[model samples]
Target: MLMPIAALLLTYLVTLALAGLAAFVLRRPLWVLLSELCGTEERSSFWTVWSMVMMIALPLLFVSWARVETDPTELLQGTVAATLTGILMAMGGMGLAVWLRVPRADSL
Candidate 1:
């Protein structure tokens, strides 16, 4: 139990750092897209990177929630219901990440 917990923790932290690095490097496309969406004369690098990180983080959290996470454990346990719910949650998280990445009208 202790070993697995340590390993999971290590894995989560390492992967999160990698994901953040990847998001930072790939920030240009998001900057372009967001700039277009906001109709801004200049790209907002702060918001762009922030959105990218959030987009990556959301799904990662959902994945960690399932096993070691029992709600997701059922899916791992091969239950059909769990599988459907897991897929739905993943999609919802993805959508939310994208939604959150988008600045609201008021923000613009």
Candidate 2:
């Protein structure tokens, strides 16, 4: 019913928030990785943080999707779908970070 839907949305939001926190913590490492991968000297701190956040949030989103399902089959499907969605989102975020010219600031 609506309860399951609400629960799923809530879980997604919670996961997103957690990812944001993770991104904040792992921004530097993410930036370094991205910089090396792209073979660019330019640094986009904001994008790195955002991408890392998305990556961290992805697994939580899959867990939430699985939790909201009633049937085991549906849950499995949801988990797979959620995982793919998370991967796409993370990749998109990383691509955006690399394409955007956001300035990098010194980390504390």
Candidate 3:
């Protein structure tokens, strides 16, 4: 029981880290698109910081999750928890970026 829960948490953490890396790599493109669409000289430094945080957080989550046995019921619960945690972490990273007033650069 406890092992399953731990596994779920670990998976969630790993997913978060992977997602953050993806975001970091795509940050430049994302910022360019947003700037062009919005026609604002705003910058988004949140991607890099968030990516770093996720890189650390996700692996931990996954390792913890993997400690449990692979049962159907446990798997389902773990998936849901991991998904929600990732989403929340992403949002929080965005929020932090906004709060920090990171400078926006023109990608053109």
Candidate 4:
């Protein structure tokens, strides 16, 4: 039980790191593209940040759920772990985006 939980925690952490890095690297370009597509002069990091988080979070949750045993306790624990992991990843990603400074849509 402990070993499986540990593995699950490690899996989520590693996934968070990778996903956050990817979001950091791509945020600018994605923002530019989205702004253009929407024809908006305003600059908002909402799309890039949340979209990336959801993109990874949803699939991860599904996969983790499918992989877990039918035991109620195990399912509850896995759900909690995945939720916490996602929250951490999103915060990290948002911090990165802000630290780097997303440019104005028209500036690029």
What tens-digit string does per-residue lDDT give for candidate 4 at 1-108?
446676566556655565567567766777776676545645445566566767467536644665653455765566556655665665566557555664768789
* Candidate 2 C-alpha error for residue 41, in Å: 11
- From the highest lDDT down, the ranking of the candidates is 2, 4, 3, 1
Can you write out model 1's per-residue Cα lDDT over 1-108, one digit (the tens) per residue? 235565456445544554556566657776776676667735466667556656456545654664542233433343333333444454465457558777689987
Best by lDDT: 2
Q: How many backbone clashes does candidate 4 have?
A: 0
Worst 10 residues of 4 by lDDT: 37-46
lDDT agreement of model 4 with the native: 0.60
Pairs with steric clashes in candidate 2: none
RMSD values for the candidates in order, in angstroms, are 7.8, 8.9, 7.9, 10.1
Descending-TM-score candidate ranking: 4, 1, 2, 3
List, residue by residue over 1-108, the lDDT tens digit for candidate 3: 346566556555545555566556756765654455445554334444445466456544543554454665766565556555655665576567544554557532
> Between 2 and 4, whose lDDT is larger?
2
Give the alpha-carbon lDDT of every model. Answer: 0.54, 0.61, 0.55, 0.60
Give per-model TM-scores: 0.46, 0.43, 0.40, 0.49
In candidate 2, what are the lDDT values of residues 8-108, reduced to their tens digit? 66556655665555556667777786776556655445556556656877667566546676454564466556765676677676668555644457532
lDDT (C-alpha) at residue 82 in model 3: 59
Instruction: List candidate 3 stretches off by more than 4 Å.
Output: 1-30, 33-67, 102-108
Candidate number that wins on TM-score, 1 or 2: 1
